[model samples]
Target: MPLMRPRMATARLTPSRRPHPVTAAGAKPAAASTMGGTLRALSLLAVLAAAILATGCSTAQIEQLKHSRTGIASGERVVILARQHHSTHEAELDFVECVGNALSRGANGLEIASHSDFVNGLYPWFEPAIAPLNPEELPALLARPGVAERLAETGVRYVVWMDGMTERVDGGGSLSCAAGPGGAGCFGLAWWETDARYEAAVWDLKHVDQAGLISADVTGRSVIPAVIVPLPFISRPQANACRGLAQQLQEFLVVEDQLTR
Candidate 1:
């Protein structure tokens, strides 16, 4: 198989920024209580409205990679790997697992290799400390006779490297909580937004070159308001990101539609 140069592209969703009001000190207890109550009511209304409006909105975005035709065939064996640096996050592992499961179930009929199995079987040949190889490093690593034999024995043709993280980008508002003899209570309003960004690089081991790169970004906001009662709104940014990345991987690998003989 002839080596194919990798193609890369990026897509981003820019969040609209709004200035947050600075909390001021020396506010009277009565005035503060009144203001907090009013803000809580308004925040509750805003959360409800936003939830309804956001039902029709999607937070995921994908930038497709352009590359020459990969000689990959349907039902090919593929392994999904999370960068060693990214392996620290449980969410990252979950994302990779989602992608692998989706690929296995997609029309492409790809055989998704288990990450644990791949790591264990490949063993010292592909050290974990050195694993999650970048595109440039893959060719040389795969070119080694022992590594090549191990990969062949494992029947893995393509390797997908996933790296990135989701983080809280912006936050505002404040919520206070207290416990009384009667019960516990939380008051005021609080909210935060998160952005999930990840990139998948496809390496064709047979060709000893990178196939392409797929990038997905998902941003979502969650709001919580307390009006004697705490109302929590969840954004589910990680879930959205997982779905988007999985779908893009299916399309990028041309596995979305079944191949007809």
Candidate 2:
């Protein structure tokens, strides 16, 4: 991959920014407490789910990737922390969805706890740590600083981090032909090629929200490891890739026996 200079990080928080109030006034302490927890949980899931489609798009290759994986255990729950920097809420949501799907398949006992609403975050460390790509290229930045700490405080056990980018390369073709008859002897040949690809990475952290020094793993490829041919130049490839990844992951978890029903 050709390296590009990093672009300045920017914040694009989801339109829905206010955190759901955990407790409502004028209510009994016990009931309020239970309601607060339930509301927060529901809000988180809603936010995460919305983030999945924020990027706004999909493709056939993405479809294949979606259907490839399996289910998680009958009922083990997992948490998703999808923070985005220099990206849209849609992209973030797509990532959350994708990871949720993957877990369902890879771990039979796993279930998807609701995901948190999209948050505006920064990727301050990724700059020099990961070369070439822009800050936007890597989504893990959202987790590096205090974001992880915040999530842990929220009672999240595991975190799935996601980010993506799309690029176009030189696409050209060559051909050969043999001589046959008169002046028009040789046969004419033409080849068409387009070099365009979108990649989405889903990272898993065992206990990130709590640990400052958590080891994050690039769990696996969310989309088809293979690139799409004749890239869709008119559309947003990365968005599509992310969407596919989310759906594929969902499918994988279910099939892999990670998430049942």
Please write out the lDDT profile of model 1 over residues 1-261, one tens digit for every residue: 222333333333333322121311222242346456767546645654554344323366766563434545644678988776545552478788887887778465468888888888777645657763566777667666687777877788878888788899988889899888876667777878888888888887776667777788888777665644555655676776777777767766764322222
Instruction: List runs of model 1 lying over 4 Å from the truth.
Output: 1-47, 50-58, 71-75, 85-91, 178-185, 255-261
- Tens-digit lDDT track for model 2 on 1-261? 212222122222223222223421112243334345767445434433332333122222431222112233433344554335544332345544654665556434355666533232223332323322333433464445685565444443333344433434222332333443432111122222222233333223332222111111111111110011111112233443444454444443344433212
TM-score winner among the candidates?
1
Lowest-sum lDDT 10-residue window in model 1 = 18-27
RMSD of each: 8.3, 24.6
**Candidate 2, overall lDDT?**
0.34
Model 1 root-mean-square deviation: 8.3
* Stretches of candidate 2 exceeding 4 Å from the true structure: 1-152, 155-158, 170-236, 253-261
Candidate 2 lDDT for residue 45: 40
